[model samples]
Target: MAAQGDKHKSISGLTPHEFITLNELEQIPEGFLAEHSANQMEYNDAKKKFAEICEDYGKILENGKKSQALEFAFKVIYDIEPEARSIKKVKQDKMWNFIFSSKGNDGESKRKICWIHTDKAVFKHSTNPKEIILTVKLASLLAIETWKMLIEHAQFMKIDKVLLTPSAGAIYSLKDIRFIAARIEGNQRNTTNIQKIINASCQPGGHLLAESNYSCALAAVLASTKDMKNEEVRVQIVSKVVKQYFVARKPLDVDKCRIWCQFAFDGNYRMLNNSDNDVLHKIFKYAQKNAQIIKLREVEF
Candidate 1:
């Protein structure tokens, strides 16, 4: 996060509005890392296997292999984020909830995959958040097609999260946030047109730089202190993260500093004028001198 924040604000005149990893949550024990270590390993294995399948299928699709493309798509779904396994010995055996699903109205499915070029079309409005989330989640798996969907929809979805509750996976957290940044960087690196990359990046929340690993920590903190009345504490915590990021990636470019300032102070001041450069310079200057550790007000210890 520290590294990305520096690089992020250097290139763009905006900072990320959302990004907090599970590790950074004050109350959560560091040992939670040990617990998820196994799950992380499994996820990595699944990601690698899914990538290979997508590559082969991509070749077939390019050759007008419609029949094969559908077949590969189905297989990819089963492989990526499949239903949890049941253990006979474990009474607590239950399916870990999927971050997204795709088993509902065809129209909803199409809307969830709005970015993709497809022949199938739907002319109905979507009313199902559950199905929308599931469909979006399935379309955002590790495969190329899924990754494409993720890149196209991430910003739009981030904006949409303001309308939906956390229960539907609409909250803007670490994994979703980092996925946006990483996928954008990936696309920019591979594509030849610098204009296209810039246009795509300029979408909502494209200015965030931290990696996905930071999401869980941020979400945990928000969950632990939902009733706190101290906005300053929250601001301080966020400032600490931003300061560390800039210090590590020192002397941010003019544009990057602007973006980071926007993300950090998006609503701190009323936007009355177009003079953002002047405003951001002052904010970053303050951050540079006051990069100090912040202690939360509502600590459990």
Candidate 2:
């Protein structure tokens, strides 16, 4: 037992040199060098065996084009990982909750109008970024489609006053709707004539309303009060709408108009006043400075 214990300790503690050394240097064979070549050979054989086992394991996991082996491996992995199962169950519960909770409605009456703020492609100039231009045009098209859908929905629900929120941008001008209506009525395509009509509509005292947050708020109020038939409440709602209409009718000042145009154009002020080259130049300079400031702020963060 003592000899066995000593043997186990030597097996565990022997260094590479001592383990490979011959018991008697004088009894060494004639062709044998002092160094052990068999030790390196054995080590290489063991490494090759390990590499072959890894390759076989990989092949088993990648079994055929159907990926059945991979699926099975993943199933095993998922089974072993308790946290993954918990996360999947949580996700399933959330999905079921969302599906069941969507049944409740606000109980508002169906007789309601919708007002949409029109989107416009503000920066279509050659100098602007292509992505920004594309985004603007896409938003404008989406707004037009949304307006058409809202109008149809309102008509189907037997409601009136599907108001199209106005913008200073020419692309979203009310004149575009009239142009579409005219085309539907078989009017000929005349670019110059259409531009003239749009220009006329944009002049002071025209039907177009100023773009304002108040317009959106008032629209919401009107829609909320549609079912309230109490005489005083009805009178108040009507009065508020009338007041907003008059306020929107007032011609916006130059600075305010430029700001509104900036908002509508997605901060591209260069596209705001195309009629006046000098004003357009000034707006372009301002936009460039503003963009630099924004870029600097981002870099600072």
Instruction: Show where candidate 2 strays beyond 4 Å.
Output: 1-134, 168-301
TM-score of each: 0.27, 0.16
Q: What are the lDDT scores of the predictions, listed in order?
A: 0.28, 0.27
Candidate 2 lDDT score at position 289: 48
lDDT of 1 by residue, 178-281 (tens): 33334334442222222222222221111121222122222223333334578556545443333333332323344433322232232232222343343334
lDDT of 1 at 254: 42
Please give the clash total of every predicted structure, in order.
27, 0
